[model samples]
Target: MNVSNLCVLTVTVICMVLAWSEPSKACGSCTCSNGVVMSCPNIVQISLRSSGLTNLSGSAFQNNKIVTNIDLYGNQLVHLPAGLFKATTKLQTLNLRYNLLVDLPDGLFKATTELQTLDLDDNPLVHLPAELFNATTKLENLYLSRVQLDYLPAGLFDAITRIKVMYFWGNKFDHLHAGLFKATTELESLYFVRNQLVDLPDGLFKATTKLETLDLKENQLVHLPVGLFNATTKLRKL
Candidate 1:
């Protein structure tokens, strides 16, 4: 081939590669439909499950301010930037399950006040900040199963007064605080299966009057506390 022709072909190939590698101007690094990326608006859901993501930049979703649901399930994320979701104020459901998260920032969900369901299951989390859910006041369904938690800080769920379903299965908890569910008056289903709990505090479910299903199977409990279900009038399955 002539030198001029070879040079032109090389430049054309490079341009094509750059065009394909460049991220969408609107969605940043997040995947978006061709039409959506061109328009750069109306993005409501972000699903990046099983994408082998190890970490995310703080500005990953900065342009997706009105996004409502974000699914990052089955990834390798070890930590999340503190203000990762600062602009996602309208987010309702966040799925972080099946990741390698060891701990989360205290105000990770501060701006996600509209959040309702949060799934943190199947991670290796060791500790949780007491005020983690303080700003998620609208949270209802919480999934903490298999996170390797031994103890939960007091007042952890104080702001989630509207919580309904909670999953605590497959943990290392030996005992829980007496007032753990003090603010979960609207709780309906509570799962504590596959834990190391020896005995439960008598008033643990006192404030969970609306609780219906309590799963305590596969625990190390030797005896039940007297009047444990006294206030759980709506409880049907134990």
Candidate 2:
């Protein structure tokens, strides 16, 4: 083959290898007959979202204990097993959006200290345990939108430092604690739409100096907090 054709073939092989790099780690040992995984990949991420898998068993992740990102969005998982991710503690991003998870067990994310982005939106979680995000310091984006969270446990965002965006829309939050955003100095965008909050604390954006967007639409807020943008210099969206 000519040089150009040979080069094209090499690139095609690389692309094909990358497609199967991420193993199916979402619905392991499921009775839904999604087929056997056979082998767990040592790749960087695993995505089995919306795979029509009915039964979500813990053994599904036994083989792929080293993968970093695990996306199980839109699955049939009703309950998460405790220490289910203990072996995959090196994980960075975990997307559990649009699942059937009703309640999150304690220590669910404690082991995944390297975790950065955690998407728990569109679930049925009523309350979050304080220690749920225990030591995930590098965490950046957190999505808890469209859930049944009535109250946000205090100091829940303490360990999360690299946070840039946080989505907590469609919740039942009537009162937002003043210290909630104190630790998130690097935050940029915050979406709290369709909530039950009445008011926000004054100067809450002082600590969030990097904040640019704040979406609190369709909420029960009667008034915006005073000095809310007093410290926002680069405020773009509201």
Off-target runs (Cα >4 Å) in candidate 2 are: 1-41
| CA lDDT, every model vs. true structure | 0.83, 0.73
- The whole-model C-alpha lDDT of candidate 1 against the native structure comes to 0.83
Per-candidate TM-score against the hidden true structure: 0.84, 0.80
lDDT of 2: 0.73
Candidate 1's C-alpha runs over 4 A off are 1-39
* Candidate 1 residue lDDT tens string, 39-130: 22455666766766777767566666777888888988998999989988999999999999999998999999999999999999999999
Indicate the worst ten consecutive residues by lDDT in candidate 2.
Answer: 29-38
lDDT, candidate 2, residue 53?
Answer: 45
lDDT of 2 at 166: 96
For candidate 2, give the lDDT of residue 213: 91
